[model samples]
Target: MNEFKCKLCDKKIDATPYFEVHEWSYNEHGELLGTSIFYCDICYSKYLYKEI
Candidate 1:
C-alpha cells in the first residue's frame, strides 16, 4: 500500500475521505500553473473554519 501525508500537519493519512487542496496561477497571457497538496480530515476542517 502507498502512504500519504497531510501538507498542513504532516499527519499520516491512512484512509480515504482526505482532502486535496489545489491552487492555480495564471499569467497575463492565460498560461496556467497548478499545484496540489493533501490535507487530513482534521486539518482540512480547521482550515475551513478559520476566519479570513
Candidate 2:
C-alpha cells in the first residue's frame, strides 16, 4: 500500500488502529475557492490542539 503524506507537516502517515486522515476545504462565503488539503492524524491533532 502507498503511504499517505500529511500536507500540514510533510510527514509520512503511519498505519495504526487509531490512524485517521483529514480533508480541509478552502472556501469563501460558501464558495469552494481551492482544492482540499489533507492532514495525517498526527498533524491534524497538532492543528486542532493549536486551535484550542
Candidate 3:
C-alpha cells in the first residue's frame, strides 16, 4: 500500500478512515485553481470539531 502523511498533524495515514480536505480558488474569470490536504482520522475529527 502507498503511504500518506496527514498534512495537519504529519501523522502517517496507515489505516482506514483518513480524510481529504480540498479547497478551490478562482479569479474573476472562470478558472480552475485548487488544492488538497490529507488528514488522519484523529486530526480530521479535531478539524471537524474546530479544535485545531
Candidate 4:
C-alpha cells in the first residue's frame, strides 16, 4: 500500500485516493527554485478552488 504524510495537515495517509500534482520549483521570473511543494488531496482541492 502507498503511504505518505500530508505536507499541509501532516495527516498520515495509507493510500493515494487522488493523483498527485508534481511541481517543479520556480520563481517569479520563471527561473528554477531549489525546493518543491507537495500538496495533499484536500489542499489541492482548496488550491483549485482558490479565489484569484
Candidate 5:
C-alpha cells in the first residue's frame, strides 16, 4: 500500500479509494502549483471552487 499526501493541506492520505487528481494550472496565487494532489472529496471540491 502506497501513502499519498495532499498538496493543499499537507495531510497524509490513504490511496485506497482512489484519488481525485487536480492541477494548479491557474492557481499560481494559491501557491499550490506543484506540491499537491488535492486528495479527497472535500479537498477536491474546495480546490475546484476556491473554497480554500
Candidate 6:
C-alpha cells in the first residue's frame, strides 16, 4: 500500500479516508499500473470516466 494525495484539494488522504470509486489501469495479470485519482467524496461524478 502507498499514500495518496488529492489532486483537487491538496489533501493527504489515505485508503483509510474511504474512497468509494477507485479507478486505475492494470495489466492482464491484475497488477496496478496508473490511476485517475480523485479526492471528491462523490468522486464518480467529478472525475472523467476511464476506459478500463
**Per-model C-alpha lDDT, please?**
0.53, 0.42, 0.52, 0.46, 0.42, 0.48
lDDT of the structure predicted as candidate 1: 0.53
**Segments in model 6 whose C-alpha atoms lie over 4 Å from true places:** 22-52
Better by lDDT, candidate 4 or 3: 3
Q: Indicate the worst ten consecutive residues by lDDT in candidate 5.
A: 43-52
Best-fitting candidate, scored by lDDT: 1
| Residue 49 of model 3, lDDT score | 15
- Rate residue 40 of model 1 by lDDT: 60
lDDT by residue (tens digit), candidate 1, 26-52: 869998866444446757732221111
Candidate 2 Cα outliers beyond 4 Å, as residue runs: 16-39, 45-52
Best by TM-score: 1
Error of 4 at 15 (Å): 1.4
TM-score of each: 0.38, 0.35, 0.38, 0.35, 0.34, 0.32
How much is the lDDT of residue 4 in candidate 3? 57
Writing each residue's lDDT as its tens digit, candidate 6 over 1-52 gives 6555555555554553433465666789999865443334534233332333
lDDT of 5 by residue, 21-43 (tens): 54455464665553333334436
Candidate 4 stretches greater than 4 Å from native: 22-39, 42-52
Model 5 vs. true fold: TM: 0.34
Model 3 worst lDDT window (10 residues): 43-52
| Candidate 4: C-alpha lDDT | 0.46
Candidate 4 worst ten-residue window by lDDT: 43-52
- State how far residue 32 of model 1 sits from its true place (Å): 17
Which has the higher lDDT value, candidate number 1 or candidate number 4?
Answer: 1
| Tens-digit lDDT track of model 2 for 1-52 | 5445555677666453132343445446675443233345665632211110
Question: What are the candidates' C-alpha RMSDs?
Answer: 7.7, 8.3, 7.5, 8.4, 8.3, 6.5
lDDT of 5: 0.42
lDDT of 1 at 39: 47
Q: How many backbone clashes does candidate 1 have?
A: 0
